[model samples]
Target: MVQRLGSIGKLLVGVWLAGVTVATFVVIPPYQGLGDAGRIVIVHVPTAWVAVIAFTVSAVYSALFLRRRRPDDDAKATAAAEGGLIFTLLSTLTGMVFSQIAWGVFWNWDPRQVTILILLLIYAALFALRSAIDEPERRRRLAAVYSLFAFVTMPFLMFVAPRMAESTLHPNCAFIKGSDCNGITLQVGNVGLLGDQKVQLLGLERQGDIVVAQVKVSTPGLASEAILRPGYDLTTRSYTDRPTFPGQRFTLALESVNLERGEARINMEAPGSGLLANQRTLWVFLASNIGFTMLFVWMFLVRSQVLSLEVQIAQRKVALA
Candidate 1:
């Protein structure tokens, strides 16, 4: 059964990889701001997604190990975590490349960057703790418990911390709202885009010489005639401000911020059209994420099998003794 599963996994992964490659290169449209460089998103986004998914799977298996005291469950948890760490490193490296292009720095202390670093350290410590322990049973139990505890940081580090931060060069949907990260919320009557009273602009997109933006803003007690002003243009992106004018034109600046009442300003860039507007890019990104996820599963299964084999060998040695 294990051999058959492995063969099937390998076959599926091959298909997934081929599809991702074609979609990323041949099918997807170039991003507005990043252009051909935006193709990196297909890889970078999927790597990060797989890392998080692996961590989630690890946590689930850890919980199962604690409840059932099964050796297979323990092996599965460790394997998933190992895969997660590997992809986390890839995600960070790819992000650095993207950062160098977007922000002109390889290692800026961006909020998302800092949080992901913290997450990597936490997982590295998990492995270190496992290695320091001598007894197999005790180590497995402790590791399972530690994995559960560490799982709490995953959501906060990857999602919550970045959002609560002051400012970031990273995209907004890196944590929440997903595809909606680059869009503005237009208040219809009372409810917000997130079904709340408040709204925030995720980011902005620009086209050629003209800056195009659509914001749906409604702040109770704030003026109905809120204006968006374009601030500094750093030659790469542009920022907008909430001036009194409704229809204003501006050039594409690197970090143009549009200041809103009681809200921190969001940096705007013309990353081409929105990802949603371009169906091909959207499908390519989606396919890439799914492909990487399948790769994660394959790695996890292979790692678990190796661990399980080692466990069996140890059992046989004990019997001989």
Candidate 2:
């Protein structure tokens, strides 16, 4: 009965993931600036999210192993860490593909990229440490302790560090609506920084229902400058045109304007910033997240069982010896 139920659950997960794949390509429309390359987000984001979950699961089991010294708990911890590593690798690979399509480069050493790479290295070291120790008990104890310390870095590396960087080209606004993602307000002749770019509002002009702001943008160190005219539609209360900055893929967008006050809120928008704003895209993205999470659970269960079996076999061999 348990085997039958497991089979049914596996079948359901397979069907659900297949549906997500179909919806990802067929249902969701191509993003405006990113084109079809934006579709990678469905897989990329979920894999990254699953990696975080897997690491957390591993940490929990590691703590349990420490408390009880149960071999099964250690097995589960190792299995979850393995799953986390695989998913993290997938996230990195898919991100590289997306980067190639959107940024015209495979690797740019962006802050997010650097942080994830560092995280990969940290976890990889844990496995290496486990393999070097010969005694099963010592290996498990040291790995449990190391895993707890490793987990302390995961949150900082994955979330906090990337956000702290001021000049990253990552589309943080796609998932988060933090103050950094929100644009800065500037009056005519006032200067402000938008994602490390210095911007001075030069002038504003009205053409029909559109309010156009002439923004003088300069890169860090005043190395390059350009005059950008981003347009906002007063009637729609949205940006009509986002002009790309000089020598960068990011665009300057007018978020809001107060004509009477001569002030405007301008921001730097990365490629695929508003990709999830579409109803179909958002629904499919959410479904994809759900599917990936379920898939992780399935993988973790199977892997942990196999690891537990191996541990049991090793114990029998030790008993005979």
Candidate 3:
């Protein structure tokens, strides 16, 4: 009966993921500025999120194995880690595709990209460590300790380090809004940093209902500079024209303007911002997340069961010998 229920659950997950794949292209609308390429986020983000969950699960089972010295716990931990590695690879590949379309390069050494590559290498080493050991018990013990340390780095690499970067084309704010993700405010003649660019608000000009802020942007070390005029519509209280930053696809936008105070909030926008603003896009994206999580659970369970059976068979063979 339990096996029957498990089979049913697997079938449901398969159906659910198939539906998500269909909805990704057919239901969700193309994002502003990104067009069809933005749809990659539906798969890309969920895979990365699932990778984090899988690694956390692996770490928990590894802890249990260390405390109880149970082979079953070791099997579960290995299975979860394997699933995590697979999902991480998927996330990286999808992100590269997104980058090629949005940034005109497959790899730009962006902070997020660099951190994820490092994470992949770290986890890959854990499996290599497991395979190098001859004794199963010693291998599990070492892997459990190593996995805990790897988990320690996972949070910092995946979350903290990328955000700490001064400039990144990753659209982190598009999915997860934060105070720091908002741009900077500058008054005329005041200097501020936006991403990697140093900017000074040179002046503001009003053309009827539209207000344009002339921002002088300089590269690090003041190597070069360009004047960007980002326009805001006073009547509509929205951005009118967002001009592309020099030498990059990302655009500079006037988020808000206070004419009386001679100040404006200016920010850099990547290609995929406001992607979830549409109702269909949000619903589909949420559904994709749910589906991928379920798929991860299924993979973890099946892989752990197989590993447990192998351990049991090995024990039987040793006893007979």
Q: Estimated TM-score per prediction?
A: 0.72, 0.78, 0.81
Model 2 per-residue lDDT tens digits across residues 146-225: 99999999999999999888766676553332125767899999998675567899999999999999999876323557
Number of the top-ranking candidate, with TM-score as the measure: 3
lDDT per residue, candidate 1, 217-298, as tens digits? 3322234534243443434444433222222111122233332421223323343355445778777788888888889989
Q: Candidate 3: misplaced stretches above 4 Å?
A: 174-229, 232-239, 245-250, 255-265, 270-273
Candidate 2 ranges with C-alpha deviation above 4 Å: 174-241, 245-250, 254-266, 270-273
Better of 1 and 3 by lDDT: 3
Model 1 misses residue 276 by how many Å? 4.2
Worst 10 residues of 3 by lDDT: 172-181
Sorted by lDDT, highest first, which candidate order results? 3, 2, 1
For candidate 2, which ten residues in a row score worst on lDDT? 171-180
Residue 253 in model 1: shift from native, Å? 5.5
**Which of the predicted structures, 2 or 3, would earn the higher lDDT when compared with the native?**
3
- Displacement of residue 106 (Cα, Å) in model 2 is 2.2
Clash count per candidate? 23, 0, 0
